[model samples]
Target: MATITLTVNQAIRELSDIDPTTPLLWVLRDHLGLVGTKFGCGKGLCGSCTVHLEGVAVRSCTMPLASVAGRSVTTIEGLAGEGDELHPLQESWIEQDVPQCGYCQAGQIMSAAALLNGNAKPSDDDIDTAMSGNICRCGTYQRIRKAIRAAAEKGGAA
Candidate 1:
């Protein structure tokens, strides 16, 4: 057990006496009580537990808590801007009606955020390449792509 300190949603968090090797997904959901990051497969193949580590999208299920010590982690709940105004991606998602079951949307949005951050104007192939790892069971691929493009046009990540 080690005490790990990390920035979560712009706030510094000191995690005490936690198993170092424990997956960050479990730590976020169980310990920190941030349930927005879903659990699809415990394996790294699924993107359901995706989160941003210093603005890069990563699978939380495969990340060790110790590895994130002193790093900045952002979950879906923290992605939205304060007050009633939503993140541009979230707005585009709603405008595009991008979710079916909504389980995978958070991860999808996070991945899109990373993509748009790097490339504000991404082509379809670019989106496909970046989002290939995030599986949406709702089969909302077309809508997802459209929403991402819309977010880019709206300067979602910019």
Candidate 2:
């Protein structure tokens, strides 16, 4: 057990007495009370536990807590702007009606946000390639693609 410090959602957070080998997903959900990142497959294949590490998409479930020490992590709750403002992808998501079961939407959105952050205007193939890791059991792939394109049109998830 040791103390690990990291920044989350633009805020500095310190976790004490935590095993460094502990998965970041549990630390975020259980310790930090951020439940937006879900648990799908513990092995990290499903992409349901996706989050951002230094503005890059990462699977949190298999990421060790120590790996995030001194780094910045962003969850779904932090993807928005100041005071009720939504991210472009979030707005496009709602406009496109992208959620069905909604269980995977948070991860889906996080993945989309990362893609749009890097690629201002991604082609259909680009969107597919970037989002292929995230699985939406509800089969909302078309809507997801549409939302991503919509957000891209709105200036690339700024």
Candidate 3:
């Protein structure tokens, strides 16, 4: 076991004496008190545990903490604007009524953010391809797509 320090939400977080093979999802949620990244499946199939590792969205459940020693991690809580303002994507989410159960929305948003970071104006197929891994049991996909477009229109994640 070794101490790992990582940049999370623009702040340096030191994790003390953790197992090297521990999943980054647990490290974020259980160790660092960052529960915004949920655990839907222990496997990497579901996107519920998505987080940005140096601006690229990754499935935290399958990612070892040792792989993220010096990388910057961005969770749902980090998406908010400074000083309590909501991200444009988040605002668009509420405006488009994207969440039903709300359990999967955070991962959905994070995935969308990664998509937007790469392609600001993604087509329907693009959105579909990017968000395919993020499953929402409530079936709010149409709203999720709509919200992504709305956020892009307003210069979000661009």
| TM-score leader | 2
Give per-residue CA lDDT, model 2, range 71-156, as digits (tens).
Answer: 99999999999999999999998999999989888999999899988989999999999999999888999999999998999896
Q: Candidate 1: misplaced stretches above 4 Å?
A: none
Listed in order, each prediction's TM-score against the native is 0.97, 0.98, 0.97
Error of 1 at 148 (Å): 0.5
| 1 against 2, candidate with superior TM-score | 2
lDDT of 3 by residue, 1-158 (tens): 99999999999999888898999999999988999999998798879999999889899999999999988999999988788799889999999988998998899999999999999889999999999999988899999999999999998883
Better of 1 and 3 by lDDT: 3
> After superposing candidate 2, which stretches have Cα over 4 Å from the reference?
none
Candidate 3 yields a Cα-based lDDT of: 0.92
Model 2 CA lDDT for position 67: 94
Worst 10 residues of 2 by lDDT: 149-158
Each model's lDDT: 0.91, 0.93, 0.92
Report how far off residue 156 is in candidate 3 (Å).
1.6
What global local distance difference test value does model 1 have? Answer: 0.91
Q: On residues 1-158, what C-alpha lDDT tens digit does candidate 1 reach at each position?
A: 88889999899988898889999999999999999999999898979999999999999999999899899999998988877778899999999989999999899998999888789899999999999999988799999999998988888783
Q: Which pairs clash in the backbone of model 1? A: none
Candidate 2 residue 155 Cα shift, in angstroms, is 0.7
- Cα-lDDT of candidate 2: 0.93
